[model samples]
Target: MIRSGVLQITLREESATTRIPARPDCLLGAGRQSNAIDRGDVDRTLRRWGASFRTSLVFAARRSLGHIGSQHIGYDDTERSLGMSRTYRVELGDVARARDALSAVRDLAAVAQARIESLATTHDPARSHPSTDTRVDAAMNAHDLIRATPALAREQGDERIVVAVVDTGVALGHPELRRKLLAGYDTVDLGLGKVGGMELVGDSRGADFTPRDDVGHGSHVAGVVAAQGFRLSPGMAGRSLCLPVRVLAAARPSGSRRTIGVGALSDIDCGIKVACDLGAKVINMSFGTSEAHIDAGAPPPHREVVDYAVARGVVLVAAMGNSGQAEKLFPAAIDPVIAVAAVDERFEVSSFSTRGKHVTLAAPGERILSLDRHGYRLSTGTSHAAPFVAGVAALLCARARRRGVELGTREVRDILVRSAQARPADGHRDDIGHGVLDADAALRTLDADLSASPHGRTHTHG
Candidate 1:
């Protein structure tokens, strides 16, 4: 079985920096695209490297969260192809440990852009894997966001919309989430036996894999997004279909004593594409890579995928990191996607919630209750905060469908922003964008848009 610890290389036709014929990897970086930035020779070169690294999912972000977009939300991209002489695992169980290769391939256009394909863990220890004791329901009832809108209070059904939980994995047996989950793909096992996006943007698209959640983070995040209200009891949200895509894999090499949860931005990119292809209207990302950590101008692995989703009419929402500092996070920091921060019942931003221009708005990330394997429980983090926005976005989609009007990502984002209860702060209200997410306000905004139409087309509910 081809495994991890592989060295991925990239070369260019004309580079003043490199010496040709580096390591004798056959024909590497033979030609360049007309754009020059996008190379075709490298695409073929990657295919020859080995089954495309599964390119599916390498696992990195989140202590449990996913990037580091279910990026276990912070998949660390860049530096994946920096060093060339590393080991290259071939598909037929062949290993090519190339060394002393700098002189073999002179056409190395750019060497700095390439690095190891393996994802390095990027979890913030100060605020990851938050688990609070069984909190009282009264704690939830006091949340102003609970009363801020009709998220839970809205008596209705909007099960047609699909929300992809691009996180670790989701509990399939959970009573509340079991029925709502759509068939999701796991990038860990997905393969690129055939050529796909990997040739273009270096993404692994075609493959077969299973979506399974080992850590409870992805499941909890799903619950907040759309955990289906149960008959025996009720829960926070679940008005949309929950599509679970497992992108995070074990920390150790495959077939070892699996111990850690890892995620890759590439995996997140693949998951986002899978969700989009499967028709997910809203992609909920509960993990992120802090901008404070990455080098300037470094390409964000999930940025293209996130933008693609939005262009396809998918609303992307991600947790601003838990650093409580002004910085950018993957998917969330991408601008088009909604960046959610955390706030408490008093509407006070959580101490650990990230604050900066990237934040779209605040949600109840502190000790919020949602579905788990054992029933409802409380969990904290911006990881928990993002799904709430996703759920409300789903609600708006459902409402749009009823009104016979279509809602795009921007429309959804604008509705949320305009309907939000504004607060006072420095520079556009500091971290919390607009204000706390109010489900009812969003609903009202949707209705207002529908009513103001020139045609004044009207529709009704069941």
Candidate 2:
């Protein structure tokens, strides 16, 4: 778990002034020589910037250092893939101190960039509608609206494809999800204390192996993507494996008994990277932050890692946000990552679904029935809708693999947009990029394109 109230500093490429001696205590190993900056240099520099006694810094990927190249169950290749050695997380006592630290690091010759880490909550603002009905018929509306049944009938998805659900941890013991889940990781670092308005529900220590969902958001999202479809309705990619990366944790705000899901941007970034390293073909992000919440022109949160995952050939999908305004929300707004808006059974955009030029497509999301920590539950917002797209992406990947055809992120996205059903008469609209998702259409289109090419060329539309 990456701690909150910290500033992440990425050092510049190796230079005379930037290359300080590394300490034994520092986690800079053979491959991490690029991060060999002296701890004393950082401490002295911070003191010069008026950093309080409470300010401290540590390697951003300290927990992952020992796992490098290990055969262990929780091995993470983030440090190996993302040049993580050049990055460090500076912990601060307060927001004012964090501000000072971020400013001070810029003056350090070794520091190339620095920003205070922030948190993003789950996109689903509506309360969960818990129900006793676990019958398969109860959860058919959303899937039926998306034509998931017929799509699955054509391709039930391949077990080789893994969809990483980066959200509040999943319910490990849920009957619908247990067997379908691969071992997961928890990234919520409690650190010395909590920073945001919320508090961790159970464990007080930093993140560990277990990713049990105290808040049920991740479970619901996972169910939408790959639930076993035994007692509840089948998921979009029922046969695909689900890898839960617990970035968001259960949070209870002051004077509120109700719990919500919240996670720091750093943790989310690590979770995404780890998921990619662990062989996830598709990553589902059911949360986001608005442009107004971030600096006027600062890069979107998780931009670096998002690019890393895309480069690794992983397809990224995110919610269009529940604001229902035309403003942009990050990650989803970021290019190449599929942005999904919520549509009702009538195939019309939901009032709460955010609209923006970045929106890539729409799917059934209103009162969508999915899994909960306990049993079946109904939830709304783009959070649920994004998984529908993610699941479809998995289907496309699995189908491509079965046909011995390679599908990159761009190809998958292109297939989705071209095969989307019911485009607005005028053309691409902000509410729905092309139109509502048609999973079966996407697979059929992919097959037609593969068959037409002598060398199995992937289809693309400019």
Candidate 3:
């Protein structure tokens, strides 16, 4: 018989003792009764009694605390900011007992709340990255193909590579995405939950490392890196792996340019740290400020951070900027990065893509189809060109890893430039870079190392 306001408890006679699941609602709280037992509480109780039940209760405290949709709790331990607190992991016996334990510690706030979500196996280091063959096509422009995949899988696109795109942010729900995605961070100066400024004061409670795209720029750049490569052309089917890292934000809803410049350096630094920590082999930076020496004749602090990441085996690919002048952009102008210029479908230099000595290569940037807010749209700028090289670098890393040869940023840079199919330019125009990206030719050179083996094939180009 079921009692009113109480849950229906059905007992199943099994081979062993009759163990009951925990029911937090069965216990009274604030001199009142809960409508039903909390499933998480019951699961926790059963597990305490050594029941063989598998479930996930791991959600970062900061992400779950303020959200009422989930039954989450937070723990307090002033001793460490990030490590787990023992006070939250005590045994509560049966379902009834678990409720009692929770009620007792609920007042403590931190003891019975949520936990941080762990990174998944797909994103873990041991887990191999996805395939890239589905991204490349034979008809891809020679330059587009070179910078569009990693050197490792230049021939077939089966290699695992990681390409980081630093921009406004991405729409995680994009159709062409979801699978190849690793979590990203928000560096937009949207102060705490306020309208503008950085979130200087971070989450007060637990660790929530979920990445979100504050603006659409990162998503767009990511699309260029790993969007369904089939979108590029028939020949460029599958060959790119995109990693989204947010380093900028839309200052206003209008999308018109506004200066929220103070945190740019900090945002970029944080992004570089996260990308490196996540083991991204290649980073695509598509944003920059033209005024190199912003004030007091000093360069931004992120310059050093970029150098550090590059020194640590990170290949930095950046946009030469769209200022349409010989003026150089920091980070991009840094020697460690492969600076890119933009080209159109007809292979002409974009009027806006920045040029100068820093330019390393160019790729199709004008009218490039990439992911955006609503869905996919055509965007123009040198920003789109950088990822082509970033993807190509990923292929190179894969090839190098297979050969048991580790590559530093400098070596990677040299290989890319040497492999490039130089565009017919009137010498390096401050805007067009060394030339447009040549994926087919670049792949051929990287594959030259493994020509003796059966893994890579030999092919000559025009």
Predicted structure 3, TM vs. truth:
0.59
* Number of clashing pairs per prediction, in order: 44, 1, 48
Per-residue lDDT tens digits of candidate 1, residues 1-462? 112333333333242112121111111122111111223443344444432321112222212122112222222222122222211212212134221121222234453343333342224224334344545552354235544335456534377788888876777788777678888877643233311111111122323355666556777777767655452223233457788887754333344332233454445555676677677888887766555444343355465466556556777888887777777677688867788887777788888877777677888777666765456666677787787788778877877877675566677777888777655454245578778887777777777778787243322211
List runs of model 2 lying over 4 Å from the truth: 1-4, 15-42, 50-83, 93-95, 127-140, 192-194, 454-462
**Model 3 clashes, total count:** 48
Best by lDDT: 2
Relative to the true structure, how large is the alpha-carbon lDDT of every model? 0.55, 0.72, 0.48
TM-score of each: 0.69, 0.86, 0.59
Candidate 3 residues lying further than 4 Å off, grouped into runs, are 1-154, 157-160, 189-209, 229-241, 253-263, 424-429, 449-462
The better-scoring model by lDDT among 1 and 3 is 1
Q: Model 2, 141: alpha-carbon shift in Å? A: 0.5
Pick the TM-score winner: 2
